[model samples]
Target: MSESTKRWGLLRHHDFRQLIVAESISHLGSQITILALPLVAVAVLHAPPFQVALLMTFQYLAFLVVGLPAGALVDRMRRRRVLVAADLGRAVLLGSIPLAWALDWLSMPQLYVVVLLSGVLTVFFDVAYQSYLPHLVREEDLVEGNAKLEAVQNVAMIGGPAVGGLLVRLVGAPIAVLLDALSFLGSALFVGRIRSVEQAAPRPERTRIGQEIMQGLRFVLANPVLRAIALSTAWLNFFSAILESMILLLLARTLGLSAGVIGLLLSLIGLGALAGALSARRVTDRFGQRRMIWVSIVVTAPFGLLLPFAREGWLLWAAMIGWAVTYFGGTVYNIAQVSLRQALTPPNLLGRMNATMRFMVWGTLPLGSLVGGVLGQYLGVRPAMLVGAIGYLFGFVPVVLSPLRRTAPAPVGEVADDLPGSEQPVRK
Candidate 1:
């Protein structure tokens, strides 16, 4: 393969192709749910703002509840089995929604139960998914692999919402969820087809699960770069949750926008994210990965301030522009940081490291959702979203001030033991 072909050569691997196909189907399904689930709560159930927001809280609360132990467990099992089981579980859980609705038995409580249980399954899938990649592809291909997957996610983001809007408009939100459930089944089938063999997890050798979890925690905390990335990402997710939890309510109720229009507006974030994912490799090549991490956020996050000013007219377009820009930057930052994380950790620690990071970064989402719900309940949705947009402006501070700014990208297939304050050495 020529250098250019090799740079994008992951597609040549049959297993990698299967992985992306699985992810593509799953991402599209997920994007549909992202719009449909909340709409189900708002439109069908006539849920109040706080209750609508609580849906998000229930969805992400699993990360905090099972995040650490999930990592240890993933490391001890076949990641592919974990992925398939999670996918099947989510399918069954989501499939119940349409069934309940059909039987005229759907309730807010059922929605909450479905979301919460589905989230637990998602937690396991996500940790195993990240940990499974290195086993599937070479170290040098990490960035490319992550970028392609991220791109697939963004593409789904662009199309799924538009499709979801049409589906919701035609069939109502409850039936729309059925597609997502089916997609999970499709994802499971594709994943099952991947032929690469995952070695059996080594025996635990008497190490307790708690100690394993703490070991992952210590590795992340002790490393300056990982620590800063985790902090900044957590901060970003906190505010993002607040913004996202309220956006649908604001557009649907406050601005009086239709579902179709809202879906189009939401797709703008995907447009921006797609652009970022496409450009990440070249951009990182020109600007060092370390510099790009902070630079991306610093340049694009400020646009989020425009979101608070959105109204029914031209101002809404301006707000969407801000939203798109913010997602663009966020996608770039994500690719860079995730690749770095994958490269830095030893293979055995991948599950725990990813879990610990998820625990730190995603744990705040529930809190943010709760806060957004409260703020929207008391202060109104627009004002609550304004607070979130403002918070985005400062999310870059941790990465900006960290040793990561002064560090270079770690060479492929090797750890940077010389990194300042590096405590846990990567096990070869």
Candidate 2:
């Protein structure tokens, strides 16, 4: 390997590369599924706009309500097992859709139920997966490791929307979801094959279960950095949710855009995300992670508002492009934040910490989804979207208002071991 190439984490370790490949393929499936699911509700099921948004809201609910408990479970159990179970469970749940559809037994309500259930499992899989990264690679490698994953996801996000549109045009929406299910199984199989050494753990679960759960919440809430991020994420998600389903609806109904144009625009934005993820490490070092996170949130957030201004042809595409830039910014911001959080957290509490933050930030999603529909119903599409854009501006308020804005990266093994309820950072 070339010296410069070796300096970055491209081909150094087999485990990291395996993770990237597995996650990349899985993300493509995930993105495709997410994109296709909404299209299914709209085109095939003939559901109203509100019902379609409900599908997305149901999926996000797991992160908000169940994230903490799932995290606690992950801390006590094997992370790899959690990932495997989550993957297999999601595969079965998702696969049921096509099966039921083929049997002529599929219904809108059933699709909603499937989405919700699969989302619940994903909450466990995601929290455990993030925590497990520290065990897979060194602290210095965290940003690089996460960057690769983020880059792929960004690529998928771009492609997923476009791919969904085409698949709907070609094979029908129900079948598109199958692609995602298989990807999960693919991820499960690859993860099962990794034979690398895991960090060792001591005896599990001496502390009371309730206490353990609370400890994770306490650490995330009390930590300034995590708290700031949680606040930022919650606001961002809530506002984004507000406009979530409304975008495609507006494009189709109000602006008179073709489905192909919408898909293409979505895919084009991914190019920005790929760029952001590729350069995240250098950017993080230059600006410092904390400031960058807030700056990115604040600056990029207004993209949602631009959507309302979309008129025709160039104008509509312009708005989507604006959103893509911000989406890319948000992607890099998250990579920075995850790396920082993992670096600071003790191994034992990593899962819990991840879950606690996820729950709080993600929990508000349903309300946001509901509000969007109601606003669109009473006020109109553009106004409702404007409100969503305004709300997203709140993401940076907590960060700008806090002392965490200037903090440097915390060293590894500083997992607050001195605290009474602290457990050592759990290893595989």
lDDT of each: 0.90, 0.78
lDDT of 2 by residue, 1-428 (tens): 67777675544667767777778778888877866777777777777777876887788877866877888888888788888888899999989988888998988889878988998998998898898888888777788888888887888877877887687667877898899899999998878766675554554447766777788877877677778888888888888889775787687667766556666777877877888898888888898877788887777777767877788878877888888777877788889878888878878778888888788887878778878878877788788888887887678888777776655544434536554545564443
For residue 70, give model 2's deviation from the true position in Å: 0.5
Q: Could you say which candidate leads in TM-score?
A: 1
Report the poorest 10 consecutive residues by lDDT, candidate 2.
409-418
Candidate 2 stretches greater than 4 Å from native? 1-4, 7-10, 203-205, 256-258, 407-415, 418-428
Error of 2 at 86 (Å): 1.1
Give the alpha carbon lDDT tens digit for every residue of 257-338 in model 1: 8889998998988999999999998898899778888899999998988887799888998899789999999999999999
Q: Enumerate residue pairs that collide in model 1.
A: none
TM-score for each candidate, following the candidate numbering: 0.95, 0.93
